[model samples]
Target chain A: MTGTITEAAGAADASAPRVREMSMQQAVNAALRTVLREDPRTLVFGEDVGALGGVFRVTDGLQEEFGAERVFDTPLAESAIIGMAVGLAMNGWRPIPELQFDGFAYPAVDQIVNQLARMNYRSRGAVPMPVTLRLPSFGGIQAPEHHGESLEALFAHVPGLKVCAPCDPQDAYRLLLQSVRCDDPVVYMEPKARYWDRRPVELAHDPGDMPVGRSRVLRRGRHATLVAWGAMVHRCLQAAEYAAEDGVELEVVDLRWLKPIDAEGLAASAARTRRAVVVHEAPLTAGLGAEVSALVTERAFGALAAPVERVAGFDVPYPAGPLEPQYLPTIDRILSAVQRTLEYKRP
Target chain B: MTDTTERTFALPDLGEGLVEATVLEWLAAPGDRIGRNAPLVELETTKSAVEIPSPYAGTVVRLHAEEGEVVQVGSALVTFAVEGPAGEADDGAAGQAGIVGRVPQDGEAPRRRVRLRPPEE
Candidate 1:
C-alpha cells in the first residue's frame, strides 16, 4: 500500500523533489542555520530572538544550537538595532538584524539609508557594510495595525541598498543566502502571507553562487510580459492561468531583486512580447511597478506594441482586515490590465 | 483618619492604549522582599514581552494575578507593605523612574494616567 501511494503521489507531482516538502518559513530557518554554520563572523540578533525564538519563531532553535552570543535578542528599538548592525559590519562582523515587521522599520530609516547605504561609497571603498535586514511584509493575514505592509519601494529608492523579495520557498532559501554573503547591505523582504506555503526544494545545490540582480522567467509567452515579485508573483502566475482560458499567453517574470532591478532580463522579455504589465502589492503612485514600467519603456520602447500597464494597491494606507481584498490586486485586476494591454492598437 | 500600611500596585498603562496583557511569569513571590526598579513580573502584550519592575521597595504581601492570567490595565497586580504612608513613598519613586519597557527620559514629564473613558462633563 505504501509503495502504491508513493507512486501515485509521484505521478501527481512530477516536479516535486524527492526531498521533504518545506514551507517558506522553514526554508528561511534552514538557510539561516546553514549561513551561521558556514560563516563564523555572522551574527543574528533582533527583538524576541533569544528564548522566545522570535515572535514568528523564524529564529526558533537557532539560539539553542548557535549559543546566545551568536543568536541573541536586543531591546525593542528599531533604530538602535540597525545602528548597532552598522557598527558591527564596519568592525568586520556580518550582522543580520530582523526588523520584526515592515511598518516598524520606519524608525530605522535614518540609520539604513544614511549610514548603512553610504558607508562603502563615503569611505571610497575602504569600508563595506555587509548587513542583512530581514523584514516580514505584505498583507493577506488579518493582523492588527502595523503588522502587514509592503514598503519595498522605500528601500529600493536608495542608491546603495540592495533590495530583494523572494516569492517561493526555493527562492527564499537561495536568495536569502546570497543576500547574507553579499558585500553590500541588503533589504530582504519576506511575504508573511506566503510563509506557510509548502513546496519541495532541492537542498543539495548551493544558491550562494546565484547572481543577485537577475530575474527568473517562470513562464514564457508571446502576448505580454507580467513582471512581479514576492506575493504578487504567485498572483500573476494565477492570472496567467486564468488568462490562458481566453487564449492569452502571459510571460511571467519573478523580479527576485527590487533595487538594481533585472532591467536587462525585463527588457528582453518585454521586447519579445512587445507589451508589458507590472504588478505589485504596494501603492500605485510611486511603487516598484512604476519603476519597472519606466525601465521597460526606456530600454524596450522600440519593441513595444502598446503602452506598459500597471496593476497595484491603492494609494491609501493598507486597510483594516475586512477591506484588504479591495486594497490588494486580485487575479481579476491583473487579467483586466493584461486584457487592456492586449487590446491596445497603434493610432 | 485611615491607617495606610499596604498599597496596591495597579498595573500602569504600558502606552498605546493596550487594554490587557498575559502574565508570563512572576519574579517575586508574596513573601519575598523586592527593591524598587527590580523586575516583579513579566507580561506579554501584542507587540512584545516586557519585564515590569516593582514601583515600591517593600515586602510583597499578595499577588493578585497568577501566571497565564490576562490582567487588565488599572488592575491590581501586587500588594506591598511599607512603612509610613501607603502611597506617598511609591508616588515619588514612580515619578522619578519608569517601567522596564517604557523608559522615560530624565527631564520628561511622568506619563499621564491612561483612562478608558472620557471624564464626566
Candidate 2:
C-alpha cells in the first residue's frame, strides 16, 4: 500500500521542484496536505481541528481543502478519540489523531500503550496499526496548566511505539510524512516552542524517504558528543559554540527517532569523542536522556573518557509561566555539563 | 405574552465562553417527531463537535440554521410544537431551560450535556 503511495509521490515530484521558507507549523501542515493528497486511506481528526484549524493552527485550512469527512473535528474526549483511531487502523484506515496538547495525552495513554502499540504483536502482524498520534509538547509558551509538558520519555519507554521528535521545519515535514506511511503506530511529538520558528526548506523536491531510527550529526567535534532531540537540538548547538571558546569541541547529535534512537550513529559519535552529554526538557529522573546515557555506556563503554552527563529539567512538575525558563535546559547548563564531562578524570 | 403552544430551543452556551458554533449537520429536520433528549443537531465549536439534544419532545416545526451556518448562543436553533396542554408548555421550557444561559464557574469542567437517548415510551 505504501509502495503505491510512494510511486504516486515520486510521479508528482517530477513536474517542478521549489523551495520555500516556512515555519515548523506550516511545514507540518504542508506535509499533512501532501500525505492526504497521496493517500486515500488517511483521515485527520481531533478537538477543534475542523473549523478552528487546531489550537496551534498546525492543521489550518486542512478541513476546508479535504472536506469534513476527511479532516474533521472530534468530541473533546481524548480516550475515545485515540481508541477510535486504534479501531480505524484495525479496519484499514490510517488514522492521525491529534491529542491537542502533551499533558492532555495522559487520558489516551491506555489506548496508546495497550491497544495501538501492541496491536501488531497481539495480532501476530495480521493487523497493522498505522496510527500516528500527533502531540504538541514541551513548555515556554505560558499556556495554562495541563498545557505544557515534555513527556516523550513516557511514550519512548513503551516497546512498540515509534517516537519521532523533529527539531527543525525540514525534519518536521519529512518525519511527519514518513510517520504517516509507517505500518506501525508512531508518536509524532512536535515541540510547541519551535512551531513558529521559520527556516528555509526545500519543498519542491521530495527529499525521498528518510529511513527511521537515524541520527543526524549537526556539528562534528572531538572533545565530547552532545546528544539532544526536538527543541533541545538547537540549544545543544548553541552550547557547542560556547564550548568552542574554551578549546573544548562538542559534536551535536540529533536523535530524531527517540525510541529506536539511532544507536549505531550515537555509538560511533561517542566512540570518536569518548565523552557525552544528553539533554532534554523532561524531568531528570527517568527522562529519555538517561536512556541515551545508558546506550552510550553499553555500546561505547571502552571508548569513554568520562561518565555520560545529562542536562535535563528538574524532577518538579513543570512550573508556571515565570519559572519555565529556569526549568528547561539552558545553553549555560548544557555548556557546564559538557565542561564537566570534559574535565572529568578517572581516579 | 409568550406563546404557550410552542417553544423555541436556542443554541446553548457549551461553556468556555464560546459565543457561536458552526452547525455541522442537523440530525432532525422540520416535521420530524423528536423526543426529549434526542440529538437534534451536531455543532462544531472551537473546542469540539457535539450533538445538541432537543430539550422539548414534540414535532420539529422549523430548523433556523442550515448546515455549516454559524449560530450564536441564545439564538433559536429549532422550534417545536407542544404535544400536551398549553399550561404544560412552561414545564417543558423549564425542563429545557438549563440548557441555555448557564455559565460554568472557574475550574468547572466544560459542558458536555448532550446525552442522546431513545424517546421514552
Candidate 3:
C-alpha cells in the first residue's frame, strides 16, 4: 500500500507522518516522482527509463506522467549520459541518471573522473554539479556479466564526487532526494538485488534536510562494531542476529555516505567497541572497506580491542549467476570474521 | 566484379558483454537502407533496453530473425548489402562502450572504506 507522501520539502523542515511498508525500489520511485513534481529543475533519464521503466521497473510509470522530455531515455551511452548530466547540472537542472546496474558503470569512468567528479573543483567552486547518479549495485541477484558489481571505491577515490549507499528502503527514499538536492554530484548506490526488500517506511519530499557525509549507528552492542552500507547492511544485521544467539553482541553502523565519510562517528564508535569490522561488496584490493578500516586503525589505534577486520567480496571478477553467492560476503563469513577478531590476543 | 557487398552484422555487446538479448521490436524491415551503426532493431536485455546498431553502411538485405525472439552470442542478427565492393565488412568483435564498472572480481579481498564502531554509550 502507498504511504502518505512527505509534507515537508527540504532539510530544514521537521519530520512528517509515518506510513505503511513498501519495497525499497518503490520507495525510491516515489521519492523521484515527488521530487519531479515539486521541483521543475529535476530530470530523470537513463536507458529504457522512458518505455521499459528500467530493467528492474524502478522507473515505471514515470515517463507517462512526466512526459518523455522530462523523464526520458537516452541512447546506450554511459559516459555521454554522465557527461550530459554535468552539462545539465551546470545549466541549473537537477538530473538523476540511472546506471542500470553496478557492473555496467565502468564505461563512464572517464566522464565520472574527468568531468563529474571534479566539476566543482575544476570550476573552482564556480559551478556545482547537482547530479545524482543512482547506481543499482552489488551481486547475489544471480545475474550475468556486468550485472552484479559494486564499484564504490572507483567513485570514492575521486575528490569531488560524494559517494553514498542506503541500507534500507527508508534510507533509500530519503537519501535519494537528498542526493538530488545536494550542491555536489553524488553517486547514490542502491542494492540492486534488494530492490524488492520490504520494510516499514515513512515518506518525505524534502531536500536540504538530511546531512551529507554522515553514518547511522543501527544497533548498539559492546562486543564489536560491524560496519556496512547498502545491501551489505542487511547481511551484517543478519550475521549479528545469528551471532546474538551464540552470545555475541555487535554494534552495527550503516554508513549512508561512503565519501567524506563520518570519521568522527566512526572514531567515537571504535572507542566504545574497541574493535571494528568493515564490509562491502567490492573486491578487497584497494576497496572502500580497506579505506575505512585503515582510517579506524590510524585514528583509533589506542581504542582497539582487536585488529580491524574486513569482510568483502573476493578479488576476482564477480562470477556468473550460480557462483555469485560465493562472490558476496555471507552471514557465515561476517560472523567468522567477528569471531576471529574477538579471539585475537593483543601482542 | 559486380557492385555488391555482404556486410555481416554481429550483435554488439551492450556494454556489459550481455551475452544475449531479446528482440523486442524490429524497426527496419528487410531491404531497408541503414546507415553505419544506425539502429536496425531494438533489444531488451536483462540489463537495459538497447538499440542494435547497423554495423554496415548499406542496405538491409536480410533480417536473421523476427520480433520477440531471443538471440544468442555470435548469432547473426542482420545482413547488409554494400554498394561498392565484393568483400566482407570486417566488423571486429562486438565491443561495448560507455559502460559503468559494477562488480568486484573473485579470489580477491574486497575492500571497504567504512568500518563499523560502537556508538558512544
Off by over 4 Å in 2: A1-17, A204-209, B1-121
Q: Native contacts retained per candidate?
A: 0.00, 0.01, 0.03
Q: Count the backbone clashes (under 3 Å) in each candidate.
A: 0, 1, 42
What is the lDDT, from 0 to 100, of the residue A40 in candidate 3?
A: 81
Query: Which stretches of candidate 3 lie above 4 Å from their native place?
Result: A1-18, A205-209, B1-121
**Superposed Cα RMSD, model 1:** 15.3
lDDT of 1 at A141: 57
- Looking at model 1, residue A281 earns an lDDT score of 83
Interface RMSD of each: 22.1, 23.7, 9.7
In candidate 1, what are the lDDT values of residues B7-98, reduced to their tens digit?
77877655332447799999999889888889889998765798888888888999999999999867788888865675565465542236
lDDT of 2 at B1: 42
**Predictions' DockQ, in order:** 0.01, 0.02, 0.03
TM-score of chain B of each: 0.71, 0.73, 0.67
- Label model 3 with its docking quality class: incorrect
| Residue range A1-347, candidate 2, lDDT tens digits | 43433322223566634567888888888888878888889999999888888876788899988899999889989999999999999899999999988999999999999999999999999999999899988775655567668988999889899999999998998888889988999999998767767887665335455588988999998888999988788777877766666666789999999978888899999999998899998899989988999999999999998899999999999886557778888777776676677667789
lDDT of each: 0.80, 0.80, 0.77
Instruction: Please list the residue runs of candidate 1 whose C-alpha ends up more than 4 Å from where it truly belongs after superposition.
Output: A1-18, B1-121
lDDT by residue (A88-195, candidate 3, tens digit) is 989989999988778778898898899988878978999888899999887755657887788888889888889898878888888987787678889999887567
Q: What is the alpha-carbon RMSD of candidate 2 to the true structure? A: 16.4
Estimate the overall C-alpha local distance difference test score of candidate 1: 0.80
